[model samples]
Target: MKKIILSASLAFILFTNLKADAQIKLSDIFKKVTEKQSTTSTTGTPSSLEIGQGIKEALQLGVSAGADRLSAKDGFLGNLAVKILMPPEAQKVEKTLRSIGLNSLCDNVIVSLNRAAEDAAKEAKPIFISAIKQMTLADASNILLGNNDAATSYFKRVTTAQLLQKFSPIVTNSLSKVNASKYYSDLTTQYNRLPLVKPVSTDLTGYVTQKAIDGLFIEVAKEELKIRGNINSRSTTLLQKVFGYADKKKG
Candidate 1:
């Protein structure tokens, strides 16, 4: 009887301890879940909408800045990096002209080319914004985590055709407005008449239009790099959050 009673008491003790232990474990789980919920509410990951919009906004700002800077007077002419120069085929023409004391003519052609580029750059902002608005969510996500110039590369890819079509007419008009077409024709005519020179028939409008587009992309790439690498370049909360997550992912 004593043994039986002792066994019952021990079982009761064990049951009580088991109940206490289960309660403690359950409490711990609840606390952990609550803490996790709090952390998530305070600092959650950015959603697809935020990521997509953030990338689009950044591109918009970058492209606008690029267009504005390049459209300014002396914008292309003053910047050695993006300065329009004589096409490769016409380098010899330029040299010959310069050697014959036609330096003024050569200078005029170069200045006019850059001037046309600057004039056409004024139309870039709206086209770029339109292209950016059409970007897919997948593209935005890829650009957010891709290389520093990924956004620039995507922009170039998607907008090049439209830009070419859009810039050609403007560049042609700008060339005329700036007297580039006349100067180029006069210069080429002079070069073509040189003894034993192959007839040069370069398309000045096409060359200038292509070069102007290239220069704009260079400026856009610079801005994209700045936004990706420098935290301060993220001008909005969404940009901060989206790129901040990218920073961590990269690290």
Candidate 2:
């Protein structure tokens, strides 16, 4: 009877302790969950705003470097990775011209296309900077935890339309400045005049605008890769702090 009584008391105490411990654990879990749901990541890492700032600085570097390189003479024409060429739709035109010994005209058209892209690239910095300023905390967090080109992809997705709108006039002016239209007109006029060949259109503004944007993004991606992969590219304390977290998370 004594043993039975002792066992009952022990069980009662155990039950009470278990209840208390469960309550404490539950409280701690709730606290942690609350903190997790907060708008920023501030535990042992930079805050979301700081991350956003770092990203902007990084993108600024990327955009500035890319735009500067591409704005230089032969920036696109010389760089095979991003050189603008005859559109696929116009491939037949190029072939026909080349076959007829109009290779110089084809060459001029290709050069002008690259030149227009280079001319429009110089104006991309301010637009990209403005877009970076509007990045949300969610965007910062996602980018912080994302792959090397993730930020670049996000910028492209958000800014492509605006960039198109902005790049149009610059490209248009560039085409005129470099006489790209005249060269294209010459190509099409010759091609259409040939018997048994389908008529080709002369306007290339839409194609140039799209291709130039694509080339710019390619350059931006290269800069992003450098920033993510190279310590030297993290040019500021904010970048160091934010990217440090990214490295840890990546590992």
Candidate 3:
């Protein structure tokens, strides 16, 4: 009877050990499956933050490149799209002055306006970079999803007021330094000498400031359009992919 009890006890102990080992094996398999699932999830897609950051980086790069192009020699002069043209209000005066043999002074005024624009554009790079850096997720989304000039428009909207404040004075100083005021004075004197037309006075600084801003926006729009339409202009896989998504949505 005692020998029989001993054998039964051994069998029970063996069964318990087997059951424990099986449970441990099953737990290990479950852990491995959980770990694999976690790895897949992590690798499968980017987080929202990551996506936002990528968009911001693309915008910043675009802005930097675009601004650099604008600041280069003959950048505005070479690009007809953004070339500084005579203001409509001043055009009449310009023509009248030129017709009366003040052509040299008219040319000087035009050249000085463009020069002021060029000088003020130098200050735009930092402002543009700062604005790009401050881009929020909403801003990024709008830029990514809006029209071809959306990004340019966004920058214009956000930076215009501040840019004008910062740029106007510089433009004023540039014009004065380049003797634009004298040229205008000479032209106006010539115009006033005309008996048919009334003596007209205008603010050279304000007119030039507005024109400079307009020219900058025109160039930025061109850059934005290039990026939107030309894959080669993207310059990066992220830009291509993000803008590709935007194009797809449009189509």
On a 0 to 1 TM-score scale, where does candidate 3 land against the true structure? 0.76
* Candidate 3 local lDDT, 21-51, one digit each (tens): 9999999999999888765542333445544
| Clashing pairs in model 3, backbone N/Cα/C closer than 3 A | none
Task: Encode model 1's per-residue lDDT on 1-251: one tens digit a residue.
Answer: 99999999999999999999999999999999998876554244789988998899999999999999999999999989899999889999999999999999999999999999998999999989988989999999999999888998898888899999999999999999989989988999999999999878789999999999999999999999999989899877678888888888899
RMSD of each: 11.9, 15.2, 9.1
Q: Which candidate, 1 or 2, has the higher TM-score? A: 1
Q: After superposition, how far is residue 139 of candidate 1 from its true place, in Å?
A: 1.3
Q: How does each model score on lDDT?
A: 0.91, 0.86, 0.76
**What's model 2's overall lDDT?**
0.86
| Candidate 1 accuracy as lDDT | 0.91
User: Candidate 3: worst 10 consecutive residues by lDDT?
Assistant: 41-50
Candidates in descending TM-score order: 1, 2, 3
Worst 10 residues of 1 by lDDT: 36-45
Quote the RMSD, in angstroms, for model 1: 11.9
Error of 3 at 176 (Å): 1.1
